[model samples]
Target: MSWTHTFTNLCDWYTHLLHNSPTGTIHIHILRNTITSNPDNVEHILKTRFDNYPKGKPFSTILDDRLGKGIFNVDGDYWKFQRKMASLELGSVVIRSYAFETVMDEIQTRLIPVMASKAHGENGTEIKTVLDLQDILRRFSFDINCKLSFGLDPGCLLPSLPVSNLADAFDLTSKLSAERAMNVSPMIWKMKRFFNVGSEKKLREAVNVVSNSANEIIKQRREMGFATRKDLLSRFMGLINNDDIYLRDIVISFLLAGRDTIAAGLTGFFSLLSKNPRVEEMIRKELNQVLGPDQESPTFDQLRQMHYLNATVHESLRLFPPVQFDSKHAEEDDVLPDGTIVKKGSRVTYHPYAMGRMKKIWGPDCLEFNPERWLKDGLFVQQDPFKYPVFQAGPRVCLGKDLALMNMKSVVAALVPRFDIRVVEPHHEPQFVPGLTTTFRGGLPVKVIEKKMLST
Candidate 1:
């Protein structure tokens, strides 16, 4: 297949191959890449016989300039050490509660107020205002993640909605890094890098901006003397002495994970809800019953009891996962569970985006946006990690899974009850932008109206 075709509609192209191939795997020679939507193959690469599949040098080289030896970009001892530290910190009750508190504060103080201002007309007359919800949510998540991960607030969610240099640079770095994975040959990008021209130049500048900002934050925190803060950076600082470079890489990884993933998930969820009013209504009913008619933010326990709302979020993730695909390189020649021989130095990617649409995996109604698939006896049903690897599976499973879900649910609970959101172009299908994470090509534009009862 041509790189142009693969680039044009990545998810569709992967799905097409999965449907046609008997083993649910396809090989592309551009990078000697193997893409699979097979759950057994996914389990093999991610869990069973996992040692053979590492992020490898190619994957590391692409992201090393930006990510460094951060947990997401490294393998072996480096990844294991950071993973152990983060797992313990992220799993703590105190950290979870602190994260929830931060999310609620952001929602109540910034997100809701911004939406309310947009929903209410300047003269106090009832009028729906057109807003790009994707941008708003991105700003909202950026502030929350900065506060939670670095103990610093970028103030991207303020009334002015100021532009954030760190956020923009991070976005550019991530996009360019992902673009490297699609190159027909590494020589092209290597030549550009060697010449210090074009996108590579922009990437270098962006990485410098991001790195400098993170280093400044670290220096400031160090000067303040690592207080008993619950933020991830503070916790890591307590463990790893004074390595600011390592700290910067870790902070960037957490920031990317926390901000982009939540924003993408919420964007896809709201977009889907606009097309499916019944699901939105069901979510509102669940919220109304659990939190009462008052627009109070949900407590951790209250958020836990929101089964239907949880199911809807899961349904959204199933349909539009934040990270569409992940790649690993083989350490040596080995065979996948489904008898596909893996060659040493070959890149293998498992497609969560295509897996969600597979009839074999999700059954006959796979294409339907039905939240009921995730509910049984009015409680959210857990699918196997290999089958639903949106947060990924095995040892590298996301440490922030619970925190991400809580942040997402809190935003949904806080916003959905107070306002009605309608997609401005209801009939238009969003064009997916292929990058480190999946996001709409432009942005999700919507019209928001304050609910009369909630406003009163």
Candidate 2:
């Protein structure tokens, strides 16, 4: 594959190589990277032989500065310890309820009102308005994450929607960290860091800003005596004491996990919904049946019962996964399940974006945005994790999977039934921004008009 072309069209380039390859895999000699879209290979790397492929030094080096020793960027006992603690906190019913309540509060109090103000004129007269839905969702997710992760509200979704220094710094940190992976040579970024110049200088400033903010939150929580709070940071503090840096890492990781992924998923989902009115209608119908014409926030059980909405969310994830591809380095020489050799230090990646588009994996209509593929007999059907590793697979599967789905479903349940979102550039394909998460290059521009009727 041409490096120039791959750089230009990352997902498409990977899809072309994987589909055209006889082995469903391709190796880029220049980068010593192996890319695979095969489910068997994905299973082998993620589950069957998981230990051999750790995040390794190369992958960790890119994110280590920003993530520290957080669960996402670490491996071995470090990862296991953090994972166990996180699992306990994330699995608790009380925490789930807290998170759900936070999301609902944001949506009801902030999200809806802001969008309504935009849809209606500033003074409340009827007006057609265009807004960047991507920006709106990002603000929504950031506010929710701040509350759930740090037990603080950044007020990002307020009417003024003030620009947040912490949020901006976090965004720059993520972009620069991702850029470290994309550089043809690590030396480029390494030298920049050593000299404290250019993007590297900006990266350092951003990381410091984020770290200081996290430290302040942790300090304040401690000063408050780590009161019985429901947020993740509070729960973590209850477990471990007086380790500020470690606590900061945990909070930052959760912020990234909870904020960007869900925001990106919602942005992609709404963008797809604007083009596919039938899917939007189906979601509205399900919401109506589940929550009635009043369109109240869904209870846990009610959220689960909206299978069509769930399927639509799954379909959106299938197409535009927040993390398009993930790389793991081999600990030693090994063989993939499909007879591909993996040398020590090789970067082996399973391309979720490409796998989602592969006809062999998803059938002839793979490229189409059809939610029916995920539904059978009016119920949502679970797919093999290896084939749909959006939240990943095996022992390292995302612990926040349940929380993320609930958040997405709740937002859809509350919003879709009340608004008609029309994409301003329906025919224009938005380019993907290369970052830690998948974001649109410019933004998803749309016109959101409040529905006249309360019923679907």
Local distance difference test values of all predictions, in order:
0.88, 0.89
Give one digit per residue, the lDDT tens place, for model 2 in 301-403: 8998888888999999999999999999999999887889999999999999999999999999998999999899999999999999999999999999999
TM-score of each: 0.95, 0.96
Q: In candidate 1, list every pair of residues with a backbone clash.
A: none
Which whole-number lDDT from 0 to 100 does residue 168 have in model 1?
92
Lowest summed-lDDT stretch of 10 residues in model 1? 120-129
Off by over 4 Å in 2: 1-8, 120-128, 453-456
lDDT of 1 by residue, 400-451 (tens): 9999999999899988877788888988867787588888987999988777
Displacement of the residue 93 alpha carbon in candidate 2, Å: 0.8
Q: Worst 10-residue stretch by lDDT in candidate 2?
A: 120-129
Count of residue pairs whose backbone atoms collide, per candidate: 0, 0
